[model samples]
Target: DRVQIINDGKFIFSDTIAGLNKQRQAFNLLCTLLAPPSVTSLQKISGVTAVETLSPSQFCLHYQPDLNPTAELLNLAVTQNWQLTELMPEQHSLEDVFMNIIQQEQESATVEQII
Candidate 1:
């Protein structure tokens, strides 16, 4: 599994289910029972720009840097008494890490130039 953050503005998550049936089952359950409300609630969250289901087992959320939604979503699930499944925030890809660094540097340079 991998995630890429571009310009600190968009989040892209990718994974495969070729060898993972449990993940698929959980995902199906989430989608069937929790997805609609969760997605709706997430859409109402401030700074959330987009919500998308990338696959049966994967969903991606695009939000502002200030809003880290993992906790909120987990809390929502818990509060709603949904079974807690393994929801992981995968490590950012090396490429994404490098890009984020470069982007920060560029933004810093831009700020300096403006000043």
Candidate 2:
């Protein structure tokens, strides 16, 4: 089956389920630590695009799907002695995709207004 996503009356995405799944671009890593790692440090890593800190011990690491940094991230955690509690791919449901698209559009619009 196929699905399409529309935002602001504009067609944003059209693809099969598998294709949508392939669009996933992030992983969620939860750890038990005294302090969270530096977001700047993580973003400097190759393929890492963004780091969202859910809490001092939880982070959503966004990266290029093609150049996954999971291995490097895990290695850093081990070298730093972080007690990992959970590490999993970010499951993108249909709603999540739609929201992502909408949020991107909104952010771009805001940037445009500033420019």
Candidate 3:
């Protein structure tokens, strides 16, 4: 499946399957979780605006904004094994800019709100 990454220049937010605690998974059910922490720490830099997950493990990160491509970031990509890419938005809406990949199945229940 093609993964969608929603983030600005310095922050990323992704979706996580609600209640699928990674802490309590077997050897297989647990997906390979990725985050900026392991990347940034090893790379050595600062500032995290946000972090989210798509599905249970897939997520993205927005590197430092308004700074020269730091050696650390490059090293992070190489060392941490993070595949980097640039995303261009068709719309500039704030919602579109800053949203995680929430499940439509969960959304359906919210739409069916009963009073």
Candidate 4:
């Protein structure tokens, strides 16, 4: 099905379900390691935009999809003996997309008001 998202009388997004699914700023990965690694070290990897520690041994990495760093991360995990236990991609639902678009629009409006 096709959907269009509007915010403040402006069209924020217009596309099909598949199209919306493909529109993501970054790819999010959840990784669980037996041994914890420094968050700063993970942030240094190319394509990695952000690193969030869910726990001492679990981390969420956000990176550009076009420059996926999964291979590099796996190699580093092996070399550092992090003992990677699990790696999974985060999937967003349609509701998540709608909320994100609305949040973005709100943020943009706030920026415009400030300026």
Candidate 5:
């Protein structure tokens, strides 16, 4: 059983997956359901794993639970410019950033259609 934080640490998620696809699935589940980063980054890390969506605002990740992978994932967060914690009160969350981008894109589309 692996435990992970989601949505800037607003919720905790857990689950388990079958062989070969376990580790990647866990991470992807967290990103997709909870706090999403860039889709490109998820695609890179998700690679070849299965994912299960939980509630509309949460997710449960299933992975092999490797001790070594913890550090590896941390490194990945750094390299990809992603934050893994929700402890700060002054910073925008990963999800907020993406949501703002989506909003901007939608607004731009609407304005263009009106022109």
Candidate 6:
């Protein structure tokens, strides 16, 4: 569980993601029903935001948030059905991107050295 607040410790939102899979079918159903409404609502909030399906069981939300995307995504998912997965807020900075590239290069170099 995580909490975000704004101004004088007024709570904005809280998020929780379960690490276990208990009701798998319901989870699947929620995902199917979730996309359309989520896309619509998020777009209405921000025109530049977009929802992309990475695979049958994976989705990626690209939003330039004036509001917290994780909180919004969690709200949307729960209203559709009970869900317990981390709604990742995935807007990376330039430094993060470069760090990731550097990490990958280091890992590959280590592997090459081992080989």
Which of the numbered candidates is closest to the native, going by highest TM-score? 4
In terms of TM-score, which candidate is stronger, 1 or 2?
2
**After aligning candidate 4 to the native by TM-score, how far in Å is the CA of 84 from where it should be?**
0.7
For model 6, the stretches where C-alpha displacement exceeds 4 angstroms are 1-48, 82-84, 91-96, 99-115
Model 5, position 109: C-alpha lDDT score: 68
TM-score winner, 2 or 4: 4
Q: TM-score per candidate, in order?
A: 0.43, 0.57, 0.26, 0.67, 0.28, 0.38
Candidate 1 C-alpha lDDT tens digits along 1-115: 5333345464332334432322232211122223335567656655567777756445565666566566766776678764445555434545554555567768877999999
Q: What tens-digit string does per-residue lDDT give for candidate 4 at 1-115?
A: 8979887788998898778877643498899999867899999988999999999899999998787889999999999999999998887876887888899888988999999
Which portions of model 3 miss their true places by more than 4 Å? 1-45, 62-72, 83-91, 94-115
Cα lDDT of model 5 by residue, 1-115, tens digit: 5443344434333344332123232233243223445444433443324334444433333334342234444566677656555211123344554455456666876999999
Per-residue lDDT of candidate 6, residues 39-63 (tens digit): 4554453323666665544565555
lDDT winner among the candidates?
A: 4
* Best of the two (2, 6) by TM-score: 2
Q: Is candidate 5 or candidate 6 better by TM-score?
A: 6
Give the root-mean-square deviation of each candidate in angstroms. 12.1, 5.8, 15.7, 4.0, 17.6, 15.3
Query: Against the true structure, candidate 1 has what lDDT?
Result: 0.52
Residue 107 error, candidate 2, Å: 17
Stretches of model 2 off by over 4 angstroms after superposition:
1-17, 23-35, 97-115
> Which stretches in model 1 have alpha-carbon errors above 4 Å?
1-38, 82-84, 97-115
- lDDT of each candidate versus the true structure: 0.52, 0.72, 0.36, 0.87, 0.42, 0.45
RMSD (Cα, Å) of model 1: 12.1
Better of 2 and 5 by lDDT: 2
